[model samples]
Target: FIRLMAKPEKLGDLREPRAYLTTIANGLVSDHWRRQSVEQTYLDALTLYPTEHQPSEEQRALPIELLLQLNTLLQQMKPLIRSTFLLSQLDGLTYRQIADQLHVSERTVKSYMAQAMLHCLRLKNQTDN
Candidate 1:
């Protein structure tokens, strides 16, 4: 691993440090990617599991697992875009309310909302299939 990371020039008779570091870095990246893949696979499996039923008192807009997934997806978005989308859609804010809060024009607010909706829909379609 270190050898790859170091990418050392061929040594006539001695090893170089760069090759070693490069090798190590390559291994780390591969391992990191593997771990991420495993995590995503697990999360996907969890999405298929049925949520527990709550009493009338505990029912909510979405099940906990679904909400967690949504939160994770939202994290991928730019913060301002996410905020605008959530405020307008989830929180039921009007376009004017969103514009006032962000101090942007109403047209800008509408544009942000459209972009966010498209991103969300694309993500949903991918996951659903």
Candidate 2:
């Protein structure tokens, strides 16, 4: 199990073999499930979208990849922050309108919008690498 669970170099330098192996295995398992959850959510969304509006084969892959990145970023955000961002961007609402709709102050809406933009820039940086 040690041989399978950890890299050879990790095993060679391990001060506590069992602890090291367990940590490595746990990380691997966590990453596996994270990727799986992202994939499942993307597939579920695609299914619910109107079939007539689906992208062509040549255009499909990039959007799907970008969508997964966007979804991951959005999932990490607060619910109100996500909603404020979407309403402002997708619905083309003004800050006052979002503040009114969300029953929050305009200052809070601006802060949420800033947080959302930072999240998007972080995702863009990740993709660039």
Candidate 3:
């Protein structure tokens, strides 16, 4: 990790090496907790989905490659754009409704949706090839 952070000479010159490492470790730990929380929330929400409308076993079992590609694509989007996409697709919100909920203009909501769609389409194209 030190080698990854900087050259050895620069790494050795840090006045508070313990503090530096502590900060990095804390950040990594916090990110892990955050991801765990998000995964738990997603799993919990899955129980609320209507059984009649739920995806079939095959549909639910997306290839790991495609899942990773989609995750990468979503992570690259701005928070607002990602939220807009989720609210529209997952929550079944209209553009106007999302705009009102997000305190943004309808045009902004549309723009965010377009940005998210383009990102997903690009990812899909890459995965398809």
CA lDDT, every model vs. true structure: 0.73, 0.83, 0.79
lDDT by residue (tens digit), candidate 1, 48-125:
756563323244323544655676678778888889998987899999999999999899988988888898899899
TM-scores for all predictions: 0.52, 0.59, 0.53
**What TM-score number comes out for model 3?**
0.53
* Candidate 1: worst-modelled 10 consecutive residues by lDDT: 53-62
The TM-score, computed over Cα atoms with residue i paired to residue i, of candidate 1 is 0.52
Q: How would you encode candidate 3's per-residue C-alpha lDDT over 45-125 as one tens digit per residue? A: 666898887656566545433444455676789999999999999999999999999999999999999999999898778
Count the clashes in each prediction: 18, 0, 0
The parts of candidate 3 lying over 4 Å away from their true place are: 1-67
Residue 84: error of model 3 in Å? 0.2
Residue 14's lDDT in candidate 2: 62
Candidate 2 Cα RMSD (Å): 5.7
Give the number of the best model, judged by lDDT: 2
Better of 1 and 2 by TM-score: 2
Lowest-scoring 10 consecutive residues by lDDT in candidate 2? 2-11
